[model samples]
Target: MRTPNASRAALTLAALFLATLSLAALPAGVQARSSDRGKPMLINADDADHALDESQPTVLSGNVVITQGTLDIRSARADVTTRNNEPTRVVLTGSPARLKQEMDDGSPFSANASRIVYDLTSDTVTLTGNVTVNQRGNTMNGPRVVYNMKTGRVQASGTGTGSGNGRVSMRIEPKNPTPADESGND
Candidate 1:
């Protein structure tokens, strides 16, 4: 048996732990371009099946390409879900679906996977099956990777040989070293 206050405290601690886990999963200072969300999303494909009913998904097949501001995504097929006449989610599939976007600091961010799901409402991108993500010079490889565009939180995991050994791996580069002063001032 637990008291109400104890339960509240446990909930708070759980929330804090989850937040810390998200922060620790990825390298610091990683975030998508802030203006990208405000820009209109443009999608192009060889063929599109625009559903008349709101409940039906809009399917795009054959060389699907989507772009928003500095963000770009390519896949063999994409299924888009909408709510209230606005896109809520997009699921892309291919031999390897690819995504690229500019980070907040103007650095390039990219990822590749067999399948990628972008949730607009949650501002999250989830990649599965041989997932590989790169930002700046840092790289992460795993079976699955989930990135929160709004919070810049990344969570990756693996139980398959996608990372070469059925494990998740990351290579984070050190920050750039400052140049020596040319004036020779001590």
Candidate 2:
């Protein structure tokens, strides 16, 4: 389903993002003073609680959200761990969840889809499921995306053999999506 036009746009966006990653003003990786100080972590949901076992780390479930600093990870379930109780990382599980990271600078970045994983220690983020990453005005979308938070590196992909630059389609204007079939065609 790749079109020549969207392919072109994706390539252009990828190039711009690569160039921007070198600039310090972009947000996904910047660390403010508060980030090192360890801002409060917030979790919200319609229902939530934590469970831990001698066999497993603390797990929080049900529309879970965990946020600290400018990094926010959301999903149906999240396992929180502290390396020696110091909160080294959090792992989330859910279909098409999202992770949004805002930098100390004015720049911001976001990932959308299922199978998204973040490495808190390294500040690296991976998005699977038609992943899209946007920085400033540049954007790229594909089946998966890997963003290195500490390094501000981003890569998007559809397949191993697919073209590195692919066209992405969007509009400055928003429009409603087509309604699903009443019979249950999701």
Candidate 3:
């Protein structure tokens, strides 16, 4: 009971629907952070609040957690900024935002601070306000600490009190310890 033109119209609609589905299935966001490129980032939170405009930042609150590759971040609240639909920066705040990841050498790295800023463009993470970082057996504590992911470099600074009142503190364990010979041979 259908004309040839009607059949053609139905076929066209079906093809259009399938094409739309395929496009919707494509992943959102461009590759902004090279280190995290090709790695899927997952975010979990009690609530996600964001602006209607996709270009604006998204805010996650209440037991927020973000994971990408080996990098893990947890905080009470976090704000994520994206450009071109890719996350460019993330700011986390809490009693103390916590971060953990594995170094290139398989050593464990961890940090905590009142505020943490992760810059995807420069591949750096800055921890501020009572910051502490522990990597392998080395530890650093200060008011501010900056870690460069690409260079494996860390910088910590205090208020320059110079009296250890708020100075940077560090503890580095020896790579190896040798025991003294019991024989006392010459």
Which has the greatest lDDT? 1
Give the alpha carbon lDDT tens digit for every residue of 15-41 in model 2.
222333432234345543245125654
Model with the higher lDDT, candidate 1 or 3:
1
Q: What's each prediction's TM-score?
A: 0.65, 0.51, 0.62
Ranked by TM-score, top first? 1, 3, 2
Task: Assess each prediction's global lDDT (C-alpha) against the native.
Answer: 0.66, 0.50, 0.60
TM-score of 1: 0.65
**Candidate 3 lDDT score at position 75:** 85
lDDT of 3: 0.60
Task: Give me candidate 2's TM-score against the actual structure.
Answer: 0.51
Query: In model 1, how many backbone clashes occur?
Result: 0
Put down candidate 1 lDDT per residue, 12-101, tens digits, no spaces: 222221222232334576566778767755666788766555577777789976677887777898776767666667677888987777
- Per-residue error for 159 in candidate 2, Å, reads 2.7
**Distance from true location, Cα of 69 in model 1, Å:** 3.8
Candidate 3 residue runs with Cα over 4 Å from true position: 1-41, 68-71, 102-106, 121-123, 148-153, 160-165, 180-186
> Which digits, one per residue and each the tens of the lDDT, describe model 3 over residues 37-75?
246556668987665455566777899766666667678
Each model's number of backbone clashes?
Answer: 0, 8, 0
**Model 1 residue 66 CA deviation in Å:** 1.8
